[model samples]
Target: MTTAEAETGDTLTEALTEVLSGARARGGLFHRAVLAPPWAVRVQDGAPLSLACMLRGDGWVLHPAAPQPVRIAPGDVVVLCGPTPYVLADDPATEPGLLIQPGDCCTTPDGTDMCEKLALGVRTWGRDADDPTVLLSGNYQLYGDLSTRLLDTLPPVLVLREGEWDAAVLPLVATEVVKDAPGQQLVLDRLLDLLLVSVLRAWFARPQAQPPAWYRAQSDPVVGVALRLLHEHPGHGWTVASLAAEAGVSRAGLARRFTGLVGEPPMTYLARRRIDLAARLLREPDATLASVARRVGYADGFALSTAFKRLRGMSPAAYRAEHGAR
Candidate 1:
């Protein structure tokens, strides 16, 4: 491989690693649920992603838009992507007795708090003492733009059957859920992150899986080099000529290949990526617009604001106000 090709490969790997690590354990919510028969809970929309694992017994996931309810057996891992509501129950026909709203606050249909009343133990909640069905759920409440690229590629619902993937961390997550030790929340958060990464990696490896364009484009010898440079150094003042030189190709050649493979010109992709990084940095409470702009290759906050608004339809301040880190 040429120097550019090797650098591109390493850059792609590093980018993937950074995204996975950055997306993890950011105020994530987890709960171990033990439910009896005749129980159903409505999960509201707006959560970026949720993971449901059936530890014992079987259950059904009812998506309103889905033609039928998805039945999950013990050891099955289900990933539900949002802005879509879904229901979990012992049977598909059962009416939802409770609703799990954003922030994991549970309430009855009449708006009565059900969280404390049904609390079973440390990090555990349930309806009945003799319940047979046990489930573990982790909710990732990521901001809309934080991991938009990765989240946009997922289906509304994804299921992994037992033995289909190596999820040894599931057992550890279960074991650690009930612990009341110090930093237990952080421990569980990291474990959930591990499980998510493992499951997604397995899912993408399937032969029939349709990976996203950005992912597939990394294999292109020409576009890959340009993408690596854009991602690895978004703060650089890059032009088509500089990028082509880095890729050992002509400006026109690099532009054509990049657009064909990545569905956008290199400059366009770079602008979007810079805005994405700026958005993430804006989430920090102390970060100023000037700092964010400088970090993302803009000459000043005004320049970044104009580009961010034209592309995202909102100013950086407004975006931070709406989806800033909580």
Candidate 2:
């Protein structure tokens, strides 16, 4: 490969890492589903992000966001990237008798909780212990503005079939899901995160993956440098000319290139990133409005509040309250 190709590959890798760094799983749901034929489970709405890997037999993912019901054979992994409702079943025609609520709570459509009744084993659920179909699932329950920003770039669902992704972590997830060890939740959390990162990284590198425009722009040295500056130092008072100087380009050239590649002017993107920073900062209980303002390049609380309210449709205080005051 040429020098520019090598450099662009490096930049893409770094950008992917930076964006995925915030994907902490915490104590979210991780389960191994051992299912029989003629079974279906409806996630009656779900977490911000969840992953499912088919380890045995086959199944289907039915979501409104997808044009067709995606078949999941052995070794296929699917990433569901929105909080919208979807279903996993033996067949697309199967009607779900069970519903999964938030927090991994399983219930009937009539609101009868069945979490304890449906237990097959540790972190394993479904009809029977010796069921033929096995699936590994993990709910990310992602919080943090940075995490949300990452999810914003993804479609509602993405599927990586067998041989299309790196399955390095699949074995580990399968092995760990059925074990009830000390600190197992934490272990599973980390493992799930690793699996997610691996699958997503592979997907992003595929020709048909259709990753976001900004993500694609990360391969351009000039535009990528400009984006990195905006992200790394949202607090910095930046101008198009200053950013262009830092990126080794003329101001007009930077503007044109950034707009063409990222589909937004340089300064507009900066403002969005700054507000994202401010919103994340506001979630900190000890972070005052004025402090959040300064950290994201605003002059004061009022200035930040005006900008924040204008962009986010609410004041910083309101946003903090809505997201929980840390």
The most accurate candidate by TM-score is 2
Q: TM-scores of the models, in the given order?
A: 0.84, 0.85
Question: In candidate 2, what residue range of length 10 has the lowest lDDT sum?
Answer: 140-149
Q: What is the Å distance of residue 18 in model 2 from its true position?
A: 0.9
List the pairs of residues colliding in candidate 1.
none
How does candidate 1 score on lDDT? 0.82
Where is model 1 poorest over a 10-residue stretch in terms of lDDT?
143-152
Error of 1 at 207 (Å): 3.1
The residue-by-residue lDDT of candidate 1 on 1-326, one tens digit each, is 99877766676567666556546556677888998888898988468788899998899998766678999998889988876889999999999998988767889989998889999998799977568999999877765433656675577888888887776678888898889998887787677788888888788767887867777788787778788778779999999999999999999999988888778888988998888788788888889999999999999999999999997789998888777654
Badly placed stretches (over 4 Å) of model 1 are 1-12, 64-67, 144-146, 244-256, 282-288, 309-326
Name the runs in model 2 displaced over 4 angstroms.
245-253, 275-295, 300-326
In candidate 2, residue 97 scores what lDDT? 79
